[model samples]
Target: MNITVFCSAYSLDDRYSAPAAEFARLLGTGGHTLVWGGSNAGLMGLLADQVKAAGGKLVGIQVELLKHKTYPGADELVLTRDLAERKAQLLARADAIVVLVGGLGTLDEITEVLELKKHGLHDKPVVLLDTEGFYTGMRVQLERMDAEGFLPRPLDQLIAFAETPAEVFTHLTTA
Candidate 1:
């Protein structure tokens, strides 16, 4: 499987980094390719390193503005004109999507993907690794949307949440 992961490009504490690392190792050992932002910074860098170390392939979708931060070890790299193009490429290359702890950029990526899924643009499974309740607020908000009939489809059908690295795969395999 080609798994697209949206995550922080900034360094994070152990609480966040540890889970991301575990997930990366799992992705690698499972023989899945990682499709992600091409940054060689922070959590993104760590993920690529661990995945490569565990024998997984890396495919980076990078924007020209951040070209200097591109991961040198990626097995394949594609440059995009902008963030929008990068996001489109990320989704285009993935069989499934996993989100790790991140900031605004990560949030933007996942939301765009979800919005597309909501419109039935794609049927790929989207799972959020809700590490340390990082996504509790987002979950509550989405649930409210579902409960209030603001969503056209059930929230659960749009995305799934996993508490552990292994659980993420379980959702993927069963998706």
Candidate 2:
């Protein structure tokens, strides 16, 4: 599987890092390639390191502006002219999408992906690893949207929330 992961480009506490590492390990050992932002910073860097150490392939879709932060060890790297193009390439290459703890940028990536999915632009499975209930608020808001008919499809069909790294894969495999 070509698993595209959207995550923070800033360092985070162990509470967040640990689960992300575990997820990367699993993705690597399962013989999947990681398709992500090509940054060698913070959580994104850590994910690439763990995945590579576990024998996974890395394909980075990087924006030209952040080229300075590009991962040095990626097996393949693609440079895009802008963020919008980067996001499009990421989705185009992914068999599934996994979102981990992130900041506004990460949120933006997931939101756009969901919006595209809702419009039937893609059917790739999207999973959020809700570490430490990090996504509780977002999940609640999405549930409300589902309840209010704000979404065109059922919430479950659009996204799956997992509490652990293992659960993330379970959702993907069963999706």
Candidate 3:
């Protein structure tokens, strides 16, 4: 599968770096390609670097304005006009989506894409790489939604959760 990894463009912690790199390695070994934000810093940069080092075929997308400030040396950096265009391209081009740790930007990207899918704008697999239970609140809200009948039971099925990169690799492969 051509997987678009929607991760926090900010950075990653040591706890996550090893597993993230491992996941990239495993994905390449399994003959899958990767897509991500193009940067040479932050978690996005680390993943792209490690993926390439591990022989993964990874592509990058970046908005032009942020390119200079964010992307120092991206292998396949594709500079676009704005965030909206960049996201639209990602949604249209990739088959599956996975998100790692992130802040507001990451939250916005993932949730917007999910909402789009929810409204029938897209049909694809979305996975949440919930390393160390980072997304506990979201999961709780999902349950709450289900309980309140605000979200369909099947909507909860729209996302997959794994606690580790190894588990994420396995789940994506076996899925």
TM-score of each: 0.99, 0.99, 0.89
Each prediction's Cα lDDT score? 0.97, 0.98, 0.75
Across residues 1-175, which tens digit of lDDT does each residue of candidate 2 receive?
A: 9999999999999999999999999999999999999999999999999999999999999999999999999999999999999999999999999999999999999999999999999999999999999999999999999999999999999999999999999999999
Candidate 2 is scored at a TM of 0.99
Give the CA lDDT, 0 to 100, for residue 168 in model 1: 100
Q: Pull out the clashing pairs in model 3.
A: none
- Per-residue CA lDDT of model 3 for 1-175, tens digit only, reads 8788887666667777767777778767766767887766778877777777676777778889787755454446677899998888777768788888878878888988877876778777788888777889987887677678775436545677878777776666665
Alpha-carbon RMSD, candidate 1: 0.4
In terms of lDDT, model 3 sits at: 0.75
Q: How far is 50's C-alpha from truth in model 2 (Å)?
A: 0.3
What lDDT, from 0 to 1, does candidate 2 have? 0.98
Worst 10 residues of 1 by lDDT: 149-158
**lDDT (Cα, tens digit) per residue for candidate 1, span 99-162:** 9999999999999999999999999999999999999999999999999999998999999999
Query: Model 3 segments beyond 4 Å from truth?
Result: 69-75
Ordering by lDDT = 2, 1, 3
